[model samples]
Structure formats: structure tokens, C-alpha cells
Target: MRLLPVGTTLFVVLTLGACSPSAPEVPVGADGRTDPVLVQGRDLYQANCVQCHGSGGGGGRGPQLNGGTVAASYPDTAAQIELVTNGKGAMPAFGGRLEPAEIEAVVRYTREVLAENG
Candidate 1:
């Protein structure tokens, strides 16, 4: 019998661990039906914002957006729209990349879903 190298063994273990089954899915809303707006928002956030804000908007390369942080910063929906559209500080401007409606949807998702979750 031949022994596997340490690096190869570690890689195999890690790969197998990653292939393990994921946790069960939970209903998104009280009635077990997710809101369309939230669904849209979630999709948009995942596509455009997840890289910086994290999967749950808990923050990563970007500032924390959960737990009323967004609400406190941008009290008005319009203000939130501006921030997300125009961007600020280290954040990149998305105004040109996304349409107005898309921006609104993402903001709604951030405020309604992400904030509420926190």
C-alpha cells in the first residue's frame, strides 16, 4: 500500500467536506410563500451586491448593511436609492450599471429583507 502525500490528502478531505449536503431550506415568509419583491431583491442583491456585502448583507469588503444600519444611514427610500445608485467611499457607482427600477428593487431587498433579518 502507498501513502498519499499530506497536501493531496488535505485537498481530498476538503473537497469531500465541500461536497457534503447543505442544510434544509426554510420558508421565507410566515405563510411559507416568499414575497415577489423580496425574491427579486434577493436575486438582485446576490448578483450585484453579495460580493461586497456578503450573502446575508452582514458585511465583508463593504460596510455592514444589516440590523437597521441602512435604515439609520438612509432614512428615506430615495436617499437609499441615491447611495446605491451613485455609490460612495470605497463602493463603486452602480447608477450606470443598473436601471432605476433594479436599483429600487435591490434597496427594498436590503431594507426589507436584510435589515429585518438582522
Candidate 2:
């Protein structure tokens, strides 16, 4: 049998791992149904946030929301909600435009879905 060098084997394993499928782009409920709140939040994010946060919250003009960045930045859910509602630095406040429920949904989406996928 042919044997791969240690470095080559490690590289192949790492490459395959990288190619593995990632978390679902959308969040689903325990019942296997899509979460309506997440759906609404995703729609709102696409409309309002994608321009800056980028698709899947990968980051662009705005700081990255994925990869646990949101969780790290705002360990407290309420703090994150407040930031979304009030805005900070270059981020514009959504409280004036979005309903309270919508704001909450979007925040949930970022923390639960985007954070995981990233």
C-alpha cells in the first residue's frame, strides 16, 4: 500500500474538513419547521443589513456579525438588542424604523443563526 507523507496526510485531512458542510443558513425549530421569527429577521437583515454586514453576516462595511463575533461582543442579549435598537458609531438606529418585535427577531437571528454559521 502507498503511504502519504505526514504533512500530505494532515493537509488532506484539513482540506476535507474545510470542505465539510456548515450549519444551515436558516434556523429551524425543534419541530423541523423553519422558525418564522428567523425568517422575518433574515428578510429584514437582507433588506437592511446585507449592504453593510454582507451576505450571511460575513462582514464588509460593518464589522462581521458571524463567527461568534456577536456573542463575544455582546455576551448579554439585552445589550446586543439595545445596540441594534439604538445604533452605535457608524451604525444607524433601527428603533426609529423597525417595530420592537422586528428588532428582537433580527437580533435573535444574528445571535442564533449567523453566529453559528460563521
Model 2 lDDT tens row, 36-89: 898888888877888888776888899999989999989999998899899999
Q: State the lDDT of candidate 1 residue by residue for 8-113, as single tens digits.
A: 9999999999775321122378887877766777778888887888776788899888888999998899998998889899998889998988888888888887
Task: Give the candidate number with the greatest lDDT.
Answer: 2
C-alpha lDDT of all candidate models, in order: 0.79, 0.85
The positional error of residue 32 in candidate 2, measured at the CA in angstroms, is 1.4
Alpha-carbon runs more than 4 Å astray in model 1? 1-33
Runs of candidate 2 exceeding 4 Å displacement: 1-24
